[model samples]
Each structure stands twice: as structure tokens, then as C-alpha cells.
Target: MASAGMRRRVEAIPGRPLPYGILGGCTEVIDVEDEHELLGVEWMALGCCPVEVWNDPCVGADESPGAPAKKQFCRPTIEHADPITVYAGAECGTMGWSYAEARQHAEASLDLGQQEAVELGFWTNHLAATATDLTPAEGPVDIAQGVAALEGCLAEQYGGVGVLHVPAGAAALLGCCNVVQRDPGGGPPTTLAGNCAVIGAGYSTANTGPGGIPADPGTAWLYITGPVVVRRGPAMTVPDRPGPSINYRTNTQRVLVERTYVVATTCTVCAVAVTTCPS
Candidate 1:
């Protein structure tokens, strides 16, 4: 027999609804340290500046059997200032390649992609004479000699906000900034785990960033951006138990904001304003 009481209760229940910011996105700067440009061209500090990078979407587990499998690694979804990525590190591959070669390869990649090099951090390096005020020589050069020459050119060119990437072997050449060397020798061409930043001999630090140095303290983690936000609100809270609770104080919140990102672009590109791309 049908129960009228049960039917009344069911009818009294409210309709279900969805929420926002669940899959939200932020258009921030370049995620990683790739294709980044120094504000005025002299990247001599451990300072952190806005960089332009790329972000690749993950493939669904069952959607594309032919596509590359997604990593078991954790991903974020929140709207970030640099959604593409950030790090003292990204992923370091095993082989070591020359800085010049790498730069050329990166440039080739742009050409292959038909990319217009607006004003990315991508640049050509020269070991000029050493001086705060530098004038880059266009003659034949050696990394050591080129570095000395670079310093002179840097005085007027370097804003001290970007990372001065040198030949993997020439990092020690520049002498204006405070630096505790990481990779003493030009080891293998390695990359960071999260941000894909190439460090060690390839990068010589003269400055630091708002988040301190870019070096990672963990063996597995090169550098972490921000894992500082923890939700405590009752509405967004969940119990501490029950393995996979989404409504309670559970543990899978990486889904709530993990995969999302923010892409912050340069405020101005060569005085024209990169913000012109969009708001």
C-alpha cells in the first residue's frame, strides 16, 4: 500500500542544484619559467617575476584509450595567478643539453608551431665583459669571456627581476648577485618536477622571489608553489573520517580547486601592453 505520509515528505524536499567555481579558471601569467622575459632585460636577482608559460589539458581516463595516460600525480583546480604552473622546479629529464642548444631548440619549437615571438623571456645569451653597466660585444665569444661582457651590458639592461640563465657551464661568471651555488658542475640537462624549470648549472641566481629561493627542500619535490589554503568553513567542511567524503572534512579536495588555473599575462609588452590580449 502507498503511504501518503512518505509521498508528502518526498514532495516537501527541495530540488537539487549545482554550484560555481567548481571548474573555475583564472587567466594569469605563464605557469612555468618558460618563454619568460625580464622586465628590462637584466635578470640578475633571486627575484620572482611574472613569466609566460603553457598549460596542457589532461585526458580523461576512459575517454581516449589512445591518448597518453594521465599521471597518478595530484593536480589542482583552483583559480591561480599562474595556472599554467610555477616552481623552483618542474620536470628534469635525464640528458644534459647546452644552453645555447636548448635555446635554439625552443626557438625552433616556436617556429614549428608558427608562433609569433611577441616578447617572451626567450632570449639569446652572450658572455660579454664584466661590469654592472655592460655593452654586449658582437664579436667571437667564449662563455667565460661572454659573461664578463654581459655584466657591463647588464647595468643598463638588467632590472634584477628575472632569472639570468647562462650556459650551463658559465653560471659562476657573473659576479654582482649573492648566490649559493646549487649544481657545482654542469651535470646533466635536468628539469624541475612541477614547473619544468631547468636549474643547476643552466641557471645562475642573482636574486630571489616573493616566495624565497626557488630551490625545493624535498627530494621528490623540487619546488612547491602554494599548498597553503585549507578550507575550514562549515558549509565547505567535512568529517575527518570516511575515506572519500566530498561533503565532509574529507581528503579529496584536490578536485575542488586542483585542476583549475589562472593565466596572468605581462601588464605591458614593449610599452604596448600585453593586457591588450584581453581583460
Candidate 2:
């Protein structure tokens, strides 16, 4: 969203990946080609989960685990595998829109805004400034269309769920962020002979096949990341009275894809300020 002049921090996985089960993922599935740098190379965990009504993705409306049960999402996410998968129940509404279209609109809007400012001599005080050179972005005014285009980018590798996940809550999460929830099965983070099997985030909730349609738009997209095998902390350390504390250094990268510079040139005689606007 930064491209749209909207500033946002790309939050990484909250903590070191739990060997066996990590709840959030979107890692290597989408935007791999379109925007490489922004792609959270390390298994991606959506920063925010939008809340809305859900529809069954795995099966039809007739079959579903019905009951108001408050249970944390169950799934597995480990390190070292390859790519993880993310899932969410989608049925019309924003989820029904196109990710590519949304992204494109945001990107183009940002690009034009920057150029408009520059062309109007809004940036560097060079006399060469005029709105005549500014060219408005082409396509639908509704950005969601361009942004939604991203949805199909990796639908193949991740299947349907890989594309988008409308998690458990939608409205409430409108401006919230996503976190990596780890499942504590107390099982070995790995498997060999006597060890436990680490299925990776790919093995997270087995595509529960979407959620049930609700009367209201209260929704949450439970997305999964691509799968990757992670090894448990050396058993030697966690024998009995010891707990393993995995360490990971966080890296921050600031990239400005677009810039807008506003400059004002007033006719010394008029004594009025001339402003530049993107039309």
C-alpha cells in the first residue's frame, strides 16, 4: 500500500517460527513475479485479517462443523521446507474481488500522483513545470479491480486457498494486523527414527474448505503459507527442564517505488501561491 502514498510497515513473523505449527502464511505464493522485493521471502504471515461473512470452500453449505465453539485455528507450520500455503473462505464481497486489480490500481494511482507533482514543477524548482505533460492512469477508478488481479498469480502452486484467505474475522480486522500463531502439539518438531514429523505450514489446517455463510459480514480469513519442513530445536537442549529459544534477527528494508514533490511558483507581482494538483 506504500505505493499508494499509504505508509505501512511490513511486519515480519512475530517470533521465530515454531518448529511444528505456525498459524500464519502467504510466503511464496503471490506477487513473486510482479513485485519481488515486497514479497516477504521468509514465510509470509498476513499482517492483518479482514473480517466478513464466510462461505464453505471445502464442501457445500450442508456439510460443516457447526457449533459456536471458540477454538484457536489448528494447523502445522515448520521451517526448512520450501513454500507454504495460506487459506481463507471466500464468497463475493471484497474477497470476491480481484487482488491483481486492487494492486494495479494502487500502484498506478501512486505512479501518476508522483508524476503529476513532478510535471507541475512541484518538485525541484526548475522552471520546466506544467500539468500539460501529466498523463492520468488508465483503467477502472475502482482500485480493487487492479489489486484483485494478484489473486491468480499463484493460484496454481497453492490451489484455491493459496490465492486468498478470508480468515475468521473480517470487519473487526479491517485495520488490524496478522500474527504467526503456533500450534503446541508437544510433538517432535521433526521426524527420522524416534522423532516426531514436522509437516510445515503447508500441513496447517487441511484446506477446511471455506467457512460457513453467516447472516452478517463478520468474517476472518485464515490464510496459510507455503509449506516448509523445519527441524525442532536439538532434542539435547529440551530434554526435560530446558526449553529451546530460537533466535532470529529482524531486517528492515525501506524502498520508495514512487515519490511526489510539490513546488509552488508565484508571480512575484501577483503575490499569490500557485499549487499543483493531480487531475
Candidate 3:
């Protein structure tokens, strides 16, 4: 077993680069220290000034001028980033690979650690979201259905089109059913039916089985979009030394990485679609 001290050593790994993934595309990333304050008042704080005919068709000059009512929003919420980690172990005996091989293994572990941080934080937020925000559609949402769901939510929020995140399987289905517009050079689909940027969540439950989100047999294709804020705390340290495990008798050394993440919604309307995609 790796001790708490060993975990600290992992956090101290020098030259560790921040990880990137699809989450970056759809979220507002903010790096914070101990805690972050989400000012709820920032969302729709200003109201549109009421318009009236110059001739006082709407109201008489004797009446007092109307005041712009402030938009109602949630109170400020304090969020703390939570840690998520991944580890890899290798044998220290002669049977173990050479130093170069062990180093490569550690590097691979680091990569996985970074990916896990992004994917876990992204999906955990999705799964934890209220069903109303994370709306559920019938099984297998088509292009038109997906667009309606996404656009409806955006309208509710008084926001224009936003990024739409779908599972890989759902993306494939949409591509097959609709002519997704892409750049001439050929890359990921640039836009879906509603002129929305489509991102296939490669690490979603539908794609990664149990490793990603827990399976919900009732739901098939799930889509999420809106004003999402991802708050990241200090990056976790990677264990520099593959120290032998204190509990295990075998001469096994391990590397571990961990980081904190908090996913939040900026407004009342965060759209999500859950539908069935037949096998």
C-alpha cells in the first residue's frame, strides 16, 4: 500500500503538464486554490428595459416611470474541488522490465491519470445532475429530436446555441441519419442539425462500459449542453520514485496521480437528453 507521504511525492512530480480532453471544449475551466465562489447573481442579473410608445400609449406621464425588475437567480454557492486519482504498479525484481521500460510505464500511467481526471469529472457532473436539467428523451434521439432538446434549453436560458455533447454511439447514429457538415479537409463533424458544435464524448458510459458512467439500462443516448463551469484545484503530484509497497511482500513499486475537480452550472437551464439507442 502507498502511504499518504508517498501520495504527496506524486503530487510534487516536476514538469507535469495539465491534461486536455473533450471536457475543455464544452466547459469554462477555472483554476482555483482552496475554494471557488460562483456568483449566482451574475446570471441574468440585468433585465431588459421596458419599451413604451412615446405618446404614453402604454402609460400616462402622470404615472411614475417603471423600474426594470432584476432577474431572479440563485444565491452564491461555494464549491470545493474534489480529488480523483489513478495508479500503476510494476515489479522491482529482475523479471521487471529495464529502467527504460519502467519509465515508459510510468509515463503511460501519467497519461491515463490525466485522462481520468478529465473524464471522471465531466461524467460525474452529468450523472449527478437533476433529471430536469439532464432531461430524458425516449430511446434513441434522432438529429431533429436532439436539436430540439438542445435548442429548447438554450432558449430557456436566453442563450444562443451552445456546445452539444453526445455519446460516441449517439454521434454515430446521428451521422448516419443526418448529413453532418464537416470541413473539406475531413475532421470531426463541425456541426449537427441545429448548427450546434457536436462533441462525441468518447469516455462516456455508453462507450467505456463500467469504467466511465454506471450503466442505466432505461436510458440510451444522453446529451448535455449549456453553461458549464469546471473548477480545478491544484494538480495532484505524481510519485517520482516507484517505491516498494509497504504492505505487499513482493518488491513492487508504484506511481500514483490525483487531482481535484468541481463541475457547476452557471444558469438555471443546463440541457441534457437521455434516450434509447437500439443495439
lDDT of each: 0.22, 0.24, 0.45
lDDT of 2 at 48: 21
Candidate 1 vs candidate 2: which has greater TM-score?
1
Report per-prediction Cα RMSD to one decimal: 28.5, 27.5, 9.8
Worst 10 residues of 1 by lDDT: 269-278
lDDT of 1 by residue, 130-226 (tens): 1122212332233333333333233223223212223222333322232223333532221121111122221222111112222222101011111
> For model 3, which pairs clash?
10-237, 10-238, 10-239, 11-237, 139-276, 140-276
Cα lDDT over the full model 2: 0.24
lDDT (Cα, 0-100) at 191 in candidate 1: 16
Across 52-135, the per-residue lDDT of candidate 3 in tens digits comes to 334533445445556633444444434233343334443344344454456555555655455444554455544334324434
Best by lDDT: 3
TM-score for each model: 0.20, 0.16, 0.57
- Per-residue lDDT of 1-279 in model 2, one digit per residue for the tens? 246567665633333443322222322222233233222223323312223345545445436657633434523332111111111111122332343333333344443332222222211122211111111144111112211222222232232232122222221221222212222454332211111122223212221212211112221112222232211111111111111111123221111223212222211100001111112
Q: Rank by lDDT, descending?
A: 3, 2, 1
